[model samples]
Target: MKKSIKISLGGLAFNIEEDAYAILEEYIESLIMHLGNTPEAKDIVGDIEARASELFIDLLSGMQTITIDMVSSVIEILGRPEQIVNGGESNGQSDKKSEEPKSTERRRLYRDGENGIIAGVASGLGIYFNIDSIVFRILFGVLLFANGLGAIVYIVMWIAVPIAVTTRQRMEMRGENINFSNLEKNVKEEFNKVKQNMEKRNVSGFFQKFFNTVGQILIAIGRVFGVIAKVIVVILAVVFISIGLIGLLATTASIFFGSTIVSLFPTFSGVTLAELIGSTFDLGSTLWIVIPLFFVLAIPLLALVFLGLRMVFRFKMRDTVVFVSVATIWIIAVTLLAFVLFFQARSFTIRETVRDKTELILESAQTSTIRLVANANILEGVDIPQKFFNLDDYSIANNNGKPMIMGKPSFFIGKSTSDSFELLILKRSRGATSQLARRSANGLSLLFELQDNSLVVDPFFTLSQGDKWRAQDVEVTLLLPEGKRVYIDRSMEPILSANQTCCMSWPDELVGRIWEMRGNKLVEIR
Candidate 1:
């Protein structure tokens, strides 16, 4: 049985057979003798020993102790001291020999830790391209200040590039041919530089320390700003996502469910919100408008959310095609919506008004009590599913599976110059031309009846079948003779124009109060 001995190689502990340890020691002694007792020699020897130790570790993966065979194999791979010395001379000769074509050496990008500030990306790039690292650093700094793209590129390079840790890696970083001679030269140069720096370290210690402290402070400030920026981005991302989602959901709901939800609120104008939007574009064209609108809003929001995640997690998604596609789609959507709105606006260029008067024959009485009430109760008995669109004025109902438009009629009361009571109906609408406007105005169906002194008017009117909304509206004015007592009902408040009411609260406070038309105004009877 062979005796096992403990040995240290390149700052690492190892168990080796007695014979293996002796062989390794002899090889190291021979290297030292050949290299001499210089600092450069020590660096080369150290690198060699470290390489050998790495090989030994790999060879003895399952074994408890390294054998002589493992040591011999490692030494053979490292080559003899004479070979290394002769190789340097041969490399010099080969450089002088122009006839001998040199093979192209593969270079790897690595951060040059020896000559770098922050990360060593610029230093590594400088070494790779045989340029001064300071130049690259200055350029990057300029780019960072100029357009902010330099920072992003620098960060990406820092994360992507590897650091040159080994002597061979350091040589490769400089685009040098990887061989024993070049590796030894690189190690020797690095040691000489290190020694020169050590000699001046005492003289520059204070300045170096001061600069290091400043660098640390700058790095700390950068980190704080980075964190703050991330927080802001995340908050913006959340907001964008919330808005996009809500808008998409609302738009989708409206499209699928029709104008049922919008119909709940009463509009001051006779036109419903859905009808107004629908007027700009037909239901088919609206699909194009809403779809594009949704994409335009939602895509950017989603992109913001993704960007936030990428920034926080340090992930890269190099999807230029997807970005371009989304941008193109958004542009298209915007263009289409603009085009539709442009034409829709022209439809309301002209306005037309049509008026008709019907004289009321009242039964002869001392004082006729004319009660104004809305005729909404007429549809209550009709077998149809009625949806109140605008308060009680407008509603939508299915008549034999066809959609019908309903509108509310507003009223204004004034004293007549004539002795008899007269009802005047004024229908107004907007269109692209005067003729179209007149046709739109004439399409409004407003019905009212006079039963003795009780005048019943429909609260809402309906447009002709298949007629698109052109802001159609109706105005009812009751021309009452002087001294005719008129009673207003509470139900007519929605359709009653408050401006014509002379500051009196319509229907609510004015209901049950008897008012006589005195000239142009209706004065309350005491």
Candidate 2:
């Protein structure tokens, strides 16, 4: 049996037969002696060793150890030490003499990190297809104006393509054969290009210097903008994360704690949080509304935070995984929200209105006046705090252990067909069916009373207990005789009708103003 030994090549461990190891060592020593002890020589040797290790591993496949035959094959492919030393001149002469076709190796797609602007995709594509990188960059920029499709495509390509890091990878990207001669030629070409650029800059005249200065200024400006962009992203991440966390916590508490905490806080519309949610959705459908709600808000915020971290720290992540996960979650959340809203809208399809009229008899008196005022006793009895929650449009209160909905009441003045004074109350509500709508409309508990010459009207109307709010509203019409006069109170401003056109802009400004009914309009009397 041949003696086997452990060897490390290009930082990779391998098991090789003693004879194979000796051959490989001798081949590498000859390359070192021919190339001389320079940094370039060291790099060349490392690349050759790495390439050889790759080839050996490929050839051994299922073998337990590398043999001398494998090592000899790898060295032959790399070429002799004398050939490598004079390959640049001899290969060119030999190709011309033999009239042989050039290598037809296929090019590979890889991100050219050495000559890239962003993620190296454009540069890599340029090298692979034998085109200018600026053309691809400009094309991508133009596509960005076509509804941002270019940006999406670029991100996908950046994530999918691998970066050309090793010398072999770079050679493959340029369709060059992975051999020592091509590698040396490529390295020398890069070194010469850099040297020429430096020499040109050193010899640059006035215009060249001016252009270089302008380029430097632009680069500085770009760096400043990059910093600003990172700052903006960080700020947005903080704001989004804060809002998402708060919304998620609130939703969780409402779901587990049964809205007990939510009820304690009053909404901007003077409605309890529980009352507003209960009005819009049923308890059974709350999950569909709440769960997707969290993902819709939270996922984007989490993604923003991740992006901000990447920008600030210049760290890399599994971008494909993060992007796909976030996109999927956002789509599902939006779909669920749409579905819940669509079904909930069906609850307000039909409207029904209920009307009640009552006649008032007054003793014969000259200059009879009707004063409109709000009933404070009823509001006090309901135990509703007088503190306004900017809810002039609607309000909710607890009445005898039941939920009550209140809405603004509007009034209109009209001439009586008969000589008697009448008051009409119209209550309106909506439901899935007309019957249900009518029942809901008839369930209101609004009150109005006429004491002496003063007419006390509730500024707001209330719905019955356990009724979901379906855009409930009330309108009060006062049918007055031609000779009767009326006075409006300032407290009733919230419930004033919007159809008035008596040169008065504000309803509250018309308070304490006396008006007499003529044919159809109420004419102001000084």
Candidate 3:
């Protein structure tokens, strides 16, 4: 049995052997001599002693006294005083300092508060993806357009990702191996960083203090709602994953089985989405539009899926490679999409109208009232078996084995400048230029006839063969003399303008009634 002495370590009483005490005292003296008497150095030494005290207790294992071997073991774990000062290069341990240590653990994401401007979120992402932090900063600034989405994302990251405070954690954030040498180096680097920051305080003290105060307030708010925030993040992540999966599946289906899947949905004139896109754009531009459109829709969804999974599972991926590759592809897709859209928009730059006028030969002696009726057989000979698209008084139909756009003409009545009745038809369309628009408008076919006191008008106007639909529309205005009455046919209900029927409760009520033009407005003649 050896002699024992009671000593206080880390506020705990420990019985130690005389020989063990001698070695421990020598180690403490050496540490003080090597690391100067600065406050930071004293704190570091105190931490080392606290760590050693805990190790000694573990090594005792129910023994009443700490042995010389226990002291040696504690010193080895904390590293010798010379080794800590020189990064493990003292006492024949030069190999440990010289040779690089292989990383055994994956890198982790941590906020670099020491170098961060605000909560260190951008800095953490910068380290994770191996990209410059300024790039992310600019990206966040741009995202501010989406209703402050950038600020929301930054706050979320600030709360979710922990700050790296310890030497081991700092090393892990940088993907470095955790060893004695690395730990010592990390500590020294942290001290140097602090010193440099202190020196730079005079340069930007106001901004630094402002950010610090705001950061502290935000952190306090985050701490108060930490649990709730985590729950919200999990719920949002799940929702995003679901949306991403559904969108990805739909995009894949549209790309691979365009016709089969697109057939289920209603399109312009019974045409599938692919067929419509192909018809709208030329073949050379189609590929550019289609491929980039797919990626433009797909990349973000895939990223959402990956991010959700990462947050849920806490797994590591090939972050740098995946991020750079996907980001490059997304950027290219957006560029191509924007380029295609710019030129396509030029196609609809101008709008023009083609007008026609007719003098109605109504015999005032025969009747004071005129009959305005619609031609029921508007699609008379077209082989269209079913109507697939009908919107805004326009529809698509098959005209002689060719798909054609059919639009119902808008009808209105007003006072005539003269004592005779007249009809005006205006065909309007859009194209690349005024001339092209006029040509498109002229291609519209509206059939109507005036005989005796009755007017017969076709409800629908058809596009001429081989003419593309450029929003072609027909407007028929009837000018009636004062004291002259006209009976509107029920079939004209579909083409009657809503603005012209505001005096009536509904558009349908205005049809199948006799009305007279008085004071430039049509009044019902009860």
Q: Which scores better on TM-score, 2 or 3?
A: 2
| Backbone clashes in model 1 | 0
Q: Could you report the Cα RMSD, in angstroms, for every candidate shown?
A: 14.0, 10.1, 17.3
What is candidate 3's TM-score against the reference? 0.55
| Colliding pairs, model 1 | none
Residue 136 in candidate 3, Cα distance off native in Å:
33
lDDT of 2 by residue, 1-526 (tens): 9999998887667889998898888888988887786556776788888878878877877576899999989887877667755644656766744642366568999989778766678999899889999999998999999789888787767656788976678888988666677666666776687689787755647875674565456556666876898788777766656665676575566544544553565432233444456655755645677677767766765665565556556663336665887798899899988898888788799999999988876555553678878776766756445423335578766555455667877777777777778888888988889998999899876788878877888777777766777888888888888777888877677677767643343676667788788876677789
How should the candidates be ordered by TM-score, best one leading? 2, 1, 3
lDDT of 3 by residue, 1-526 (tens): 7898999886667889999999999988877777676545665566567667778877976576889999998887766756555654554557654565566546799998767887787887788777888888888888877679998888778777899887666666888754344555667877888889898766657878798788788888888797787888898889889999999998987765655653574342354445456545534545777789889899999989988887777673336766889899999999988888787777678999988988788766657688988987776777544634565777665455456677888888767888788898999998889998899899999998876678989988887766666777899988888778889888778777877632543569888898887776678888
lDDT of each: 0.72, 0.74, 0.76
Separately for all candidates shown, the number of backbone clashes (residues 3 or more apart, or on different chains) is 0, 0, 0
Better of 1 and 2 by TM-score: 2
Please state the error at residue 185 of candidate 1 in Å.
9.5
Q: Which stretches in model 1 have alpha-carbon errors above 4 Å?
A: 1-192, 199-218, 249-253, 256-314, 376-401, 501-509
lDDT of 2: 0.74
Query: Per-residue lDDT for 1-526 in model 1, tens only?
Result: 9999898897777889999889889988988887777756766777677767777777976577889899888887776778755644556655635532253455678988777776778999888887899999999999999999898888767655777987777866766544334556677777788889988765646666675676556556677877898788777766756675676576565544455553453232223334445543545645656666667666676676666566456553336677888888888888887887787778789999999998887675564668888776757633344333333455655444344667777788877778888899999988989998899899999888877777889877878877767777889888889778788887777777865744355555666677788766788888
Q: Model 3: which residue pairs collide?
A: none
Clashing pairs in 2: none
